[model samples]
Target: MTMDRKGLSPDQLKEMYRQLLYPRLIEEKMLILLRQGKISKWFSGIGQEAIAVGATLALDPDEWIMPLHRNLGVFTARNMPLSRLFMQWQGMQEGYSMGRERSFHFGSPEHHICGMISHLGPQLAVADGAALAYRLNETSRVVLAFSGEGGTSEGDFHEALNVAAVWDLPVIFLVENNGYALSTPVQEQFRCISIADKARGYGMEGITIDGNDLLTVYDTIKGVRDYCIRNQKPYLVECTTFRMRGHEEASGTKYVPDALFDLWAQKDPIAQYEQQLLKEQLLTEDEIASIRQTLKQQIEAELEAADSGSTLIIDTAAELDAVYAAPAITALPTVTDEMPATEKRFVEAIRDGLYQSLERDAQLVIMGQDIAEYGGAFKVTEGLVAVFGKERIRNTPICESAILGAALGLNLEGKKAIVEMQFADFVSVGFNQIVNNLAKIHYRWGQAANVVIRMPTGAGVGAGPFHSQSNEAWFVHTPGLKVVYPSTAVDAKGLLMAAIEDPNPVLFFEHKALYRSISEPVPDEPYVVEIGKARRVQEGTDIAIITYGMGVVWAEDYAAAHPEISVELLDLRSLQPLDHAAIRASVKRTGKVLVLHEDTLTGGIGAEIAAWISEHCFSMLDAPVLRCASLDTPIPFNTELEKNFLAKQRLEQSVEELLGY
Candidate 1:
């Protein structure tokens, strides 16, 4: 009997059939465990087993695979132990940290398989980036990013595909069209007839194959994988499959009609493969029974072995590394700034600093939306694309999440990524990736995310509330992130270099109001401004004027006016490990202090700075650390109201009050 129609050899058909059956049984057992409340949660790729198994079979074992939540079958096919899989569902740290085998958590890092990420479609960018890494490193390994059709609607999906296409990355984007995304059907989610068709728009090949057909799955993936490896290009493979079971064990098939279930169940990959194997004379009824019994016993024994052991504890050593890993310390060459007498726009200084850094570090990669060719929205990257070339200064899709997510991934891979959020207001869309993932990765897993996120914050331009507003305080509150708001051209250049060199994640908040509005003598040299350090821009003996970002400029101007009152002006370049020493020293000398920032008064960095001053210098203070911030109201669209609502005069008044004390 064959593998095609009863004309295939026994081993040829049965081996592939067996791979599908193993994961199916394992998935069923896991679902039962989940239903019995023995496991936390389980996302089963039950009916869509063939593609998972086939894709793994088609690829080289050493190549990379980033499984989504439902790609347990893919993991198993790629050599993850079934017992480890069960334990992961049970939330056992041991489940994630066992053996020479690539546990789910580590995802065979040595084998080139990265760990799974929970966010939908975000993994695609990482996968593409990984492929880029392979290309850069001159490795033959390809990366496969698995996602659902529902993920197609996500901005990240388009971003990842476009990046992969533009770079001609050796990555395979596998869309497991499981008919529905959670509860939303494919039709309602996207306008595209087929998820694969989205590939054509990105200048890539898109292939649709019967997911349940193991041969078709194997053949298509093999062809695509080979094509990607050779041409170093990406392709979208849409494997059409039905989820005979619901999304998860808790979600019953009631939402799915019994008739549809019965219809897909007939074409069930496991059962159909069994029939194929039987027809090929690969397995007699007795042999099939024995194989089932043997496989079940083996899995049960493995589970029993796993169950007998203590639950895997979180890797405390790994956690320690995550929480307190020493930051990469780059020694800076001493540049005795003789106060170079020259003037330059704030943006020009930023450009100069970036150019110097690019000339300095080959590891630094600048990326953002329309950064290349477009020279960025403000022309900050005007000639960077040409100088650094597309490989380094690349453009991303309109996806804010992907831009940040890809940056984070590259940082994890030890690349310094400078990600620009075109406007500060748009940073909110990618806030989760920044605050939750980027900020917490090192804290969560002792990993250093050497990435600098540049947000053009602050209002002045008529870009309205969306494009304006200060968000430094939001990031300041998030631990594990260093926030910087450089107000001067020289400071901008120095601080930006420092942020890029710092080991921790830095949010470099460039006020759009100051990006070009301000100018100073920026030295034509690479420099480093230390993080968590504040600059004493001016000296005073009576009052301490503290501010950050755009507010720093205002505070300096206010201090210049209040020459009668000795006002020590401090520009807090770093926001996280704030220049507490500078604040305390100034406050102690002045006896009175005022904190100012562009964000709202309620929870701005000013509040934290005030608290810190009160804690450290309260006994030495003549009065409280007064604060002046924008009123708790939306930044009005009216240009007049916008200026009036957050006037520098208000800051000057606050400083005057502190002086009165």
Candidate 2:
């Protein structure tokens, strides 16, 4: 009964021994269940148990940990109920994801665990996000981010590390160098002496440790945590361990050399730790046997409880309901028509709306490249930096994936974040973070990513291909996201505020063409235009044009000029939670319908709208449903080519054709 230099009492070491043994023993049981057809899959952390156990025990209660798939020790160390863990793996109704997700692809914010997606590299950036939140909220919460040697090869790994270092974020970039990622060996992964060596390039301290030595890992992490908190800086640690089992229960280790297995067997972490405790006389042989028996009985009981739980029920209404959190439209002020003393341009209205939002909510933070001092790419955030200061109006590196991931982290900490993409086209860089992480989090784990991604979108202003592209369709197709594309200054301001105030992630697309080109009366006072509601721009009895974003502008112009044709234009402000109610009402009024959009023809939102009209309002139609959209090609650089490629040039022809029909 003696203490170590790091103040580890004999009793504490005995408890650590128990915690370490739990996952190792349970993992063996899980593999048996997998073979017996009781479970679906198993990612064994048999030999690498010390990494998760040591790290979790070292962390404070408020600190967040982003663990990978094999880190069951982190959960067991937190003392999570064995029954609930069994239910989650079995996909029961009471599971963490309610049967929507499986394995470790789930998060528990209440437990200070940031869930990781399959894309391992993105979690590094998300760890930076929670660290950034800690900085903003002054929480002093350090974060431990886990990645494998193969994941370090991803671009997000570099971007996240560089940003965290430059910003001096309180995070420990822990790489569990488990020798192989799936089947790729460490030599093929990188040429660096070790993963920790790469940390020097980011101007951060780095270290490598024996992952199998339990006490060493526990003590090292405690010191790293202290260093991060003390200096508000990032640090990197590489734990050289071996994945004892195959990648999973199915993928046998035929590729692994027999000599390596012999090498790691002698260094088995659990076996080594058990001997250390026995030598110190912490627990006798009988006590160890009794502990094992108790764990076996408990696991069996938990497995039985999981099996006896009610089977998952498939409800169509419930399935649809779970896709996106119901929109918080009830908060919208019922004043859509109140006029202001003066008119503001689309960009000004957005700026005004954002200013109002920031003034209203202290927890709301806006991050983007050049957004703080230079006022964003389009100057939409101009002069607001002076008003709000750098903390709230923060400028970030050109790391879209990291920033978007970080925004989700901010949302986890009960803060609202607005990420301004310099151009809508650049959203491609962060697409996975948006679609997979942010979009799926709410549906998978019921934690809404309550963030606003401002897409300064559409093809206009001669910015050319990369800078000018209408890519709203990408997000429109994603279920857990709300897509808002406003055409007028009023809707831009109103929808901007609404998207900011939403309880779920919202992609608010502000068309660049309307930023300065259009001026309309807008209320100086703040108000929210309800999302999922379409605005009827003009009343017509002839042909109805259903459109969003720039398509609304062109349709309005055409309707104004052609006095002979009574054209009804429906401006769908929100695309995903599309105003089906309004679209149905408009098509019934004007049977001949035309769906128009600025995006490319084939997969644009126009097709979805056209299909819906055909299905529900076919009997009311006087003519076939026609679509006006850009050619199925990239937005060109030349003016004439761009114009020809737009739905605007084809608008008059499609309207005349539909009218004649």
Candidate 3:
């Protein structure tokens, strides 16, 4: 068939042809390399090459681009060397090179390519977060996020789209509709006719483009990009494309009908564009032939360069250094020597801790919803933005997953990230990131995910189920995560400081009611309370009460009021590495025990304590270990119901019964 090129410049046509030719050649070579044991398995965007080249050509290199598996066009356009890309596919240590590799999902920031993730859809929020940071930082840069049509099925996609649209973030959502997701086709995935149409629900402009037409794709992307740059508005572009190859190397196309293949063959973007180049006289047959030869030679050269190179050798020491680059605790300021003996309130201690930590570590960053200028939902971060500047104290777009994901990436890059959830109840939004990614990094890859997550938790605020929750049990049960619940301002400051300096991921639970109502002798100076160390708040020989966070205060008060009942109160600071030593000592001494917390009695930390005691100290106990905690019902909005929901005071009454044992 004679290819026709019409209404296009020679240079433009040449660029488009070159884009298609080189990437396809490279992809094929990489696959061959896989067979020859030269490279690892790779996902190719062969049939959808036109859109990849077209869409990326219109983006700003300085602006961020979060690439997925099908974005070979993006990396190539951004100037990622062909040999290096091949090396990475081969799993070479040099192949893992990126100046900002950890931050951008393994993409080189210098190349303006953010990292690609295998986790389907969450990268959309991460791109938006980078855009959010840019907006806050007053940079003119935008973010272009790419994903497949199937990823739209994830809640992260909609959450990201809605957040970006409502906030008018400078982001472009590019959805490459490549026919099928492994085996599931778009027909079976959603009822929506086009992915772009979903953007309208978010009150954003949506466009459906012919992904094959190079000029058409370019013009469409360019227009939306300009719109975003000028108005800071976000847009969604649905690039209708097809995957000519099977899902992966092992998959076959036996399920696809010949008729569908025939129809798509006629509309092959590369062929159509080649036809246009010839038809428009943009290039003679000889010129097109010559260009093709040159591209083929270039691809051959890259393949040779990669093949001649030795197998990727990883440096164990360098990898260890990369994984263990967290700052030492000695680098942080400690307040043990300067702490005043006077009493202080819980909120004051938190404020002091934040200020001191920020002063000590300039790399420390705190971001959350309403944190900038608004202080915090509970005013814990009050005056922080004014002291630390907006760059350090950032305000996010209400995407909890995005907030946590960005924090994970930042922490990976050796930046200390501290994020707060308005209420612990809403933490469920980003629970997947915490449990799956945060908790797994240290154990899975030996990478320290140094992140401090603060949440105002527990009931009694009358905020109801949606607002009031003590869900530390959820993460405490999760391994590789440290949970800290402090009742006193002194403990809050000390534990929070320790969490910031520690190498592991720490979850700090700050009770909202205690923020103002509770007070203790907290030093104005900095101090770090050791993790996994329990403090004896009150001395008693009759029975030991083990609790944490706000529950510790109630346990102390209950012990103090009951003179007839000599209660030993132990505050277990860290949940993961529970203070078994203190628990054993108290149980063995008193010969009785009581476990307490603000969370529900069922499956709470108290349950674990009871189990542990039964396992180790069952023979030494004078009576069965009892539990004092909230009821199983959700916190109610009514004050009376909320008060009645707690088991602390009721447990105080129950202590009398336990003493009888």
lDDT of each: 0.77, 0.88, 0.77
Q: Which stretches of candidate 2 lie over 4 Å from their true place?
A: 1-5, 329-332, 339-341
lDDT of 3 by residue, 507-620 (tens): 999888888897766776777888778888777899998888777778777767777888888888778769999899989879888888888889998899999999999998
In order of listing, the candidates' clash counts read 9, 0, 18
TM-score of 1: 0.87
TM-scores for candidates 1 onward, in order: 0.87, 0.98, 0.76
**How far off is residue 454 in model 3, in Å?**
2.7
Over 1-661, each residue of candidate 2 has an lDDT whose tens digit, in order, gives 4434368888888888888888998999998888899899999999999999999999996688999899999988877788888888888868888888888888887788887898888988888888988998787679999988889999999999998998889999989998888999989889988998999999999999999988989999999999998899999999989989989978989889999999999898988888888887887889899988988888888777777788779998887788877666544474456455359999999999899999998989999999988999899999998999998898998899999988988887788899999998998999999999999988898887889999998886776889888888888888899999999888888888988888788999988888999997888888888888999988889989999888887888888898899888899999988989899888999999999998989888989999998899889999999999998888889998888888898898998898888
lDDT of 1 at 320: 44
Model 1 clash pairs? 1-6, 1-7, 1-8, 2-6, 2-7, 2-8, 3-8, 94-312, 322-446
Residue-level lDDT of model 1, residues 42-101, one tens digit each, is 667888989888898888987778777677677777767766666655556555534212
Stretch of 10 with least lDDT, candidate 3 = 96-105
